[model samples]
Target: MSISSMFSNKTSRRGFIKFCSYIASALALPASLVPKIAAALERKPRLPVIWYSFQSCSGCTESLSRAHAPTLEDLIFNYLSLDFHDVLQAASGEAAEQACEQSMREHHGRYVLVVEGSIPLGAKGAYSVCNGLSSLEQLSKAAKGAAAIVAIGSCASFGGLARAAPDPTGARSVAELMQDGQIMKKPLVNLPGCPPLPVVISATLAHFIVFGKLPELDGENRPLAFYGNTIHARCSRLSFFLHGQFAESFDDEGARKGWCLFKLGCKGPSTHNACASCKWNGGVSFPIDSGHPCIGCSEPGFWDSKGFYQPIRGNVPLHS
Candidate 1:
């Protein structure tokens, strides 16, 4: 299923080029570069990837498995040389660990290390363990040889739920580890979400493979192309907000009529993510469109929020 495997077939070439074009559009690249991306992917060696998990629910990995725009098969079979993924790979126990170690040694300073959860420094990094090594120890070993690192969810990016107030695990993010000299600094990108949109992950990796570098990042280390706009600006309900129409309850007339959920504690106004545009469940609907208010899961410390149903701070009484 590699690009080389598809070279002899005409239909696959069309499909491959189409996949490349879709990826280009998703990454906000011009139509002109689709051929370049296709050519690069067709010839460039498959990039080595190691998907590691720590204090996570495995939701980010789950999200990527469901990626549709470029399709998970397109990414796995045609683009990346995935070396290690605990949940997906067939190897288990000691053998799996050895396989991961071998990939690190073999692809030293070349593999992309993708981490999905936060590192717990509590109890001397004993809160979360994998195999016989603590999360920190394993991360340090893998990170030393990584060309770049991708922190895949709110957990790895900002300590997430594990690092909520009165946290027992002393969970810390990848950035914090680098800052504290716990893990060596490498090119890093943080795609912060409860679980980042699947396309975002695929697009980021595609950008790296095409350009031979990471995408431009914001101050918070998110790719600006994906996280630049607040969900509110692109929300389908924006006109309702502007028109002063609000849904006070999930079952209210306004709600049924597609009015804005801002009054019902939608955090879309302040949240930065591609959900409003990119959507979920394969572009079907996001929370706001499904009669649920956003909980701002993409932002840091969201788990510590007082309540998902509580109104945002500095609320203006629209009809007071």
Candidate 2:
């Protein structure tokens, strides 16, 4: 089916305009660009996407699929052409591999590569394999012709849980793997979160689609618009933290009064992400808003960071 036709049956003109507006807003783009973004989507060819998995629990995929506002189906069917996603595609075995291969060949050096898990290099990458090939092999091959690559989660961006102490699997982030072998010279973007906010994923893709380039990236290759500020800076509890009004415990009176969670181990002060603003579950609430601490899941080596519930004071090592 043609790229534009795929949405013709499911999306009305108003819906498409709304989707474009949402994308623009999510990316923090100016309202003036909404019409341009809409026009681009209407005329652009489907951007083939190859999604690969390795050492992950599929949390990232779940986050995207569970998005309720505009719905994942709407994004996948209309905005991008998901050529191959092992967990989502009906095809399996040789059929699935063929689909990926065909997309790579047809769109050579022009398709987007989205990786969802850490790549294991230990034991010759025997720790993770698809079909008969190791994770390393799959990534190297797929990345060879990719136009751009996006490592879509903490696992894929950093070693994440798989690279914690002991490191049995010798898991490495996509960028590390790329550097090790000097493969995949294509531009790369990292979206690091335990399970990145669904809208962030959509907005990044939208930015690429509309601007024909990746958004400005921070030192970690994360989109600057989303990861630009410390969560504490934009947090609703910032005043509480500054005023020394902190919740000592989960059930303390201070906690009940909606005070800061800093004393209770909130990582907001050190974590850089849009959680305080973008939020989760369709802008409803984020971890901190729900009375939990920010776990710093978006930062590298977060799993090995002191402790999730341990306050970041003398013990926790600051990123900067």
Candidate 3:
């Protein structure tokens, strides 16, 4: 994609500026930075992204694809040069392997390495393989020259379902691999979600492409701009929660009256994310909005939590 392609055609000069403003807000950047964002998008070439999946369900990639049309998410995705993706690429076997190798060689130390799933460390790394190489080998080889690493979904970021309980494959998150020296260290960011919100995913990627560096991250390496507040802090039912009106059951009267789902095991009070604001399916609704409790899919131990319907105590904070 050309430098100006993001603003060309139907994306008028005004629309372009509006987009910059939107991204600036989404990233929690100052209003004054909008101009810089606009300039950066116009001056920089399309960024290269190499997508590698391990033990995954491919829900993360599918989430990105669900971005509403004509939105910044769609445009940013369109602007990126997706060099390699197992699910999206047409080539397979040697052709696919060669293409990936060639892209790594050509864009060494510059391309973004986007990992989509958790790594299975057991069974000689046989849990997940592509192009005849195990996930570990592929990650080790690829990390040698990547400018940065972005792990999407709870699987890649925090081991999700793959690492729960028995952990049959010795599943581990990208951060864990880094901590254990199983992979090379690099500027890394984790977008943890069962499948992260589409806007959050796109905004983080756009921030990197625009600023030439990762955004301000929290302790978990999540973009603080998006994960800064607990879901309960910004939830629409917060008033209900504060008023002690909670739905004890999915079909209860409180539920019919749009009451809080805290009694129904909402983890919103402890989980931090932009789900309450950015929402899902283009900002229409999230799980709680549908009268269900928040399962806290974005948090590290969400999958292993006591139970999705088990109420978490009071509105205490677990994230700082």
lDDT of 2 by residue, 38-113 (tens): 7887778767899998999999999989765358887677667898999999999999899999999999988889
Name the candidate that leads on lDDT. 1
Ordered from best to worst TM-score, the candidate numbers read 1, 3, 2
Which 10 consecutive positions of candidate 1 have the poorest summed lDDT?
2-11
* RMSD list, candidates in order: 2.8, 2.4, 2.0
lDDT of 3 by residue, 1-320 (tens): 55456445456778777777888988899999999987887777778889999989999989888865335344544557787888887898888888888989999999999999999999999988876889999998999889999999999999999999889999999899989998999999999998998877777778888988999999999999888899988989988877888887888789899998888889898888999888899779998898888899889878889999998875465344
Clashing pairs in model 3, backbone N/Cα/C closer than 3 A: none
TM-score for candidate 1: 0.95
Cα lDDT of candidate 2 equals 0.86
Q: Kindly list the per-residue Cα lDDT of model 1 for residues 186-236, writing each as its tens digit.
A: 999999998999999999999999898988888889988788888888889
Q: What is the lDDT of residue 115 in candidate 2?
A: 94
